[model samples]
Target chain A: MGDLLRRCLMKRTDPDAPQKRRRGAAVALWGVMALLVLWALFNLRAIGDAFVQFHAFLAYRFIRRALIVGMLVSLCASLLGVTLVLKRYSMIGDGLSHVGFGALTVAMALGFVTSEGLPAFLPQGLRGAVARLCAGIAANPLPFTLVIVVVCAFLLLRISEHSRMRGDSAIALISTSALAVGVIVTSMTSGMNVDVYNYMFGSILAMSTSDVYVSVTLSAVVLVLFALFYPRIFAVTFDEMFARATGVRAGGYNMLIALLTAMTVVVGMRMMGTLLISSLIIFPALSSMRLFSSFRAVTISSAIISVACFALGMLLSCVYSLPTGAGIVAINLVVFIAFSAIDATR
Target chain B: MALIAIQDVTIAFEGTVAVDRVSFEVARGDYLVIVGENGSGKSTLMRAMLGLVKPRSGRIVYGDGLEKNRIGYLPQQTAAQRDFPASVEEVVLSGCVNRMGTRFFYNRADREKALGNMKLLDVERLRKKSYRTLSGGQQQRALLARALCATDAMLLLDEPVTGLDPNAAAEFYEVIRSLNRDHGVTVVMVSHDLSGAMRDAGKVLVMNRGMDFFGSLEDYRTRFAEGMVKGHG
Candidate 1:
């Protein structure tokens, strides 16, 4: 009786282990989210009465938009990322992320971002004034920046296309170069921008309504594409020779993968803050696979876990004045460490 | 009908030629085994014919109704794939992916075919087991079932019996023989084992970096033990 009780108390992490822990963690995670929503609702009077009621409502809309967009982008990145990591293409993911950072940096300095691109969400007078101001003082070369990022991505992708070098190595080189360029460009344009820090680590609370639509639509397309090309992706991920033999054309599939990675990375730059977005892509896949078997299960579980964490992380940021991106990562790390420990003990 | 025809094939990696102007033709219901020592280009030639490796110069022509979803290839198992987390059903189902083309979902027929192939291979009970958890013989059988899903036209095995015990190897060859004799599927396999590989193979092609001979298995056996026995030095 004593031994049986000890065994019962000890963790059992077989196939059902994931479902059990997953349910518990999910409940706890969402419980926190519920509390956060309630707390935010609780503080509604404070926000509405003090601030420009417009700004408060605007902030609320922005958070909602950011939540939608951030989750969608993270979902896209994660789906592609699981395969890429399995094929040892994390470096490529990294490089594409740098490409995103490069794009963001340029957009901040030279693009119509003097709040000009702020959509119709802002009043017309402020929008027009910001646009005109952007036209005047913007020093970052927007088109050139986009061009540079593209060339860098293509060059790395092209080299990795033929050679057997792991795509990660090429990604590492390009991403590093991009980050340095981003830093240099930022320093050069200090007097010209409003929030370099915001670009570095996304201020999710600052997102606009239009961003949500863009995220939802783009992410849905990515999910559909993955489903459509599951065979090609699975084949290439596991064995290239066998995959080719089965009629998965290599060149086209490889390029499409690169393109998807780029799109997800770029779209996520605003929410994850270019530096940490890939973690969102990677963590859930690894965590899901820790107990699940099917790729479908892993992918779905990843999305579910990601959305949950993001929601909780955002709420935590709102309540405690924590960095949103960092807070999300922290929560993810804690979950990862907790599960890993549980797995280890068992 | 000749299922596979390769002519004047030359393969080089970097600057070293692995298969020099090798050529062969395989017919329906034929079981042809190519045997050679290590670095003798058996796998290179096999891959070249399957379009896995592009020969420096060669043409591989397949008969009509036999080019698409008609060739099932089994490459040597590397440690990486053996440890992959997958189900036997999932592994076998991938074979039918070629037939799915650009479609998003595989229908019931494909699933039944995958299941039927696993059952035929006598591995139906192993369907739910993690692919990595299976033994070598089981893994090979699972892979064979996967290939069987893609086509009944031709099954190509690259050193399938290399790591198996004699009984497992014999059992595997029996499946190959049945696949050919019973189903009219053509079989092309690469082998380094002399005695076992020759059991059911109707024709034998011997080579060491080039064509050695193409003749009946009995002829190769009778001609065996000569320095360039069957012209495969």
Candidate 2:
């Protein structure tokens, strides 16, 4: 066992490999990037027409929104993913998505915004004013879901830090519990409805205009915060204790990471679905890590890959009439495999 | 005044005490090596001085124009860092984060400072390489250069040579010795190597959950080293 472990660990460092493979990796990277740019250049008119003709046969209106929101969400996810995945907090995205699902289901069931699940079990006295007061929020369940997921993110951080429970277990506990509640609420109120199915599997058509607005605004906030605190985030992620000793406010940066991740997960869950949203957070970062050595290289490439994957996935889904979420995930997997192959050859 | 003065500082986690009523002082240009067996609170005391841990009762005073945040620290490596995807330059440059002070990105000055330190540690050639790809000695040099970027006046190293081979450990010690003797940096190192660590230190602090001996290295060698070895061996 010890020999096996040592052998596995010894493979991590090969002094000659990096120096020899640098040129090849760079060539492959630029070749792919140039190909993508050329494709975009050639398809510029079709892309522009999609915007002008929203009701076109492909339902370009929904595709346009999904592409915009998907690109932003994935950009934010991949950027944050590099840090979180390094810190082993990648599953926080999965946990938060499950929590978002639970919050959405409960809100719908309580008659917050949906008429279909109108608090049938509520007492007569409490139902009228509660319904009226929450009616405004019902129109957009995003704010409610955002608030809940953000709070849960903070709680998960706290639990992982202070409690004796390990991080993975804490995540598993919260995620499973939330998912169960969502399923129970669904069964209790409206049974297995199309809305519930859409939330689970993610349909590009499920995103409303207001959801797009929220996504754009939140994604902008995420991007700005990430840019401003990039160095501190790197410091904190690399070595928390060292950063703390050097007065980097490690706790504050940790909370910031959690907060940004929560926002991304909530916004992304609308299009990617609770079940598959974490792929947006995990796949790009992992794929980029295979080929890039520097943090900057990995991060920039991850963002570009995420946005490109999302765009290509949307195109495939539009042409083949495939499920948008599955198509994106499949594309991400293919990219990951390709990158791994590149790494192996090098 | 002393660079740092620990007055009866006791550190505890939860209910159990890790360090009990430990007192010591490190003056400017002092090379203080703290030695102890495993779980003897040497590291806890060092952490308390770094302000990573708060004392249960006593005070840790920093004087001699030493800001709490400006002290360079070379901490033990964590598992996460083993596979961290960052260039050597990026890893070293992050040490300038505390000094950046509201600046979002590293400026030209920060880059120059990082490069100068890398040159000092003889790691400038490896700047563009991946950090994880370096050998153990090279990694240590990179981390030491990172520490130098934070401050030239003082350093706090916690078991910096723990996993290094004998040659790498000796080379690291020589680098630190030069930093102290030639550059006049105050160093507080918590190490397990007694005789080897004592060769370069001006002061020796023996810790067993508290201060067992705190004095000049000559006194520790002449009066306390034999008894300590006998007691702990």
Candidate 3:
């Protein structure tokens, strides 16, 4: 029995023993990759048929636009998600999206009035420019919504940090108020009920070409800013007070996070809806955190997971005639659960 | 020459005073141990020295070439902070942020300094480990490594041994004593263990919402002998 126990301990401690297990893991990984390639090849014809059907459909242009917007939104939201989730500000995304909803409703109401006609007191050129701007805002409310939501997000952050109200309570108060105002404004505005419904429960098929352009431009801005300030953001997320003590200007980094989140929330609201958009920011980060320990690793994994899940969700929705927002959220939920299970087993 | 001077500093929250009319001075190479019960503003006074809070009145002035960024601070950690998702190396490397001024990335010098500090703290082998997985003693050692990387001039620790076992705490105290004695690093430590702290501290500041006593260890022991017995009783 002593000899057997010694042998068992030697086997466990031998470094070369894990080499065999690693080889097995490598083989399994390659096998999975090969199977995925084969499956893609086998489904090529069906995918082609789906594409043809999509193109022949009346809303092909809208579908293309929605796809572009969805990809951009998913990328930015997931990138911002890692820091926000770690900093315990995950719910800020939800609050800001509701604020965007309220702003969208107000913009819609203003657009309706502008289309009816500007007052004659305005000069000719100024009238034309104002009319064009109002018309643009009416067509794509994201820019206007972005401004309102960013301002409100900053306010909420300040209130939470400096006021007697706690963080969660502040977020709840702001989000619920914005939601109530949005519902009231939507009811008050006549003839835009369908438009409001589309915003509430996103209609990807209703996205315009300009929406795609705006989303791409804003996503590029967010990506560039995030890359430039990655180090500062990491410091702030880990310990804001410590970061401040080290002269890193933690508050400035926090403002940048709020700004990025606002932009992501606005862009995402078109496809994920105001109510469901925060899931795009929350799910991927949480899932990646289960598997990766470092900030950089978790961030990269989150981005990949978010893009993959969004693509899968879009494809499933297109093939099965499902609600786009709900489909994406459901896929994210599954991925989160799978990740949690894997982490538990490990 | 004094390294830092706190002149009649008063810190308050809302309408309540936390530290009132606190005056103290830390001379060069002094090991000052601040002892107080909970809610006695020991941590608040330290924070004031670090410039974390604006004093309601008076001022904290630094001399002897010490600057705000050059002071290493080991703040009291909460559970959530202890569980921050970062590797030991990453946490230690962040101490270089002040020196890296306007630079986005840490350079080779910063990396060498971080590694050296890790070696000094005997945490070099755990460089790649996740900070959250470390035991209490190891985590404090890692944080000490980070603080050392920040500056060699001085260290200000707030309850650095709160959760450490007796042996771990004793080891930590030895490490701190060597840093002060051998390396000549000024230390301002806030601690609850007066008996243990009295062994190494050059001066002691006993506080209870105000300055109960501020003098050398021998003078403090002699001045507060009856009070200490009554308090313990």
Candidate with maximal TM-score: 2
TM-score of 3: 0.86
The 10 consecutive residues of candidate 3 chain B with the worst lDDT sum are B224-233
lDDT of 1 by residue, B95-153 (tens): 88777866766789999999999989999998887787788888899999988887878
For residues B1-233, could you state the per-residue lDDT of candidate 3 as single tens digits? 68899999888999889898989999878999998888999999998888788999989998889888778888878656666768889888888787888887889999999999999999899988888889889889988888887787889999999989989999899999999999999999999877777689999987777888788987877767756634511
Model 3: residues with Cα > 4 Å off, grouped in runs:
A1-61, A112-140, B228-233
Model 1 residue A105 distance off true place after TM-score fit, in angstroms:
3.0
Q: Is the docking of candidate 3 incorrect, acceptable, medium or high quality?
A: medium
Q: For each candidate, what TM-score against the reference?
A: 0.79, 0.88, 0.86
True contacts kept of each: 0.40, 0.84, 0.43
lDDT of 2 at A54: 37
Interface RMSD of 2: 0.7
Q: How accurate is candidate 3 locally (lDDT)?
A: 0.83
Top candidate (lDDT): 2
Worst 10 residues of 3 chain A by lDDT: A24-33
Model 1 regions more than 4 Å off = A1-59, A106-155, A164-166, A191-194, A341-346, B13-16, B78-80, B162-170, B229-233
Tell me the docking grade of candidate 1. Answer: acceptable
lDDT digits (tens) for residues A1-346 of candidate 1: 9977777777563547767876676666556556756886999876455345323433676666776777777778778777766665667766766776766665556544655458878898998787776654344333343455556656777878766775567667778877887777777776335466766776775566655665677788888888888866776666666777888776677777777676666667656777777787777767666655665666677777777777667666665567778878887776565555443334
The alpha-carbon deviation from the true structure for residue A301 of candidate 3, after best TM-score superposition, in angstroms, is 0.9
The positional error of residue A29 in candidate 3, measured at the CA in angstroms, is 21
Model 1 complex DockQ against the native: 0.44
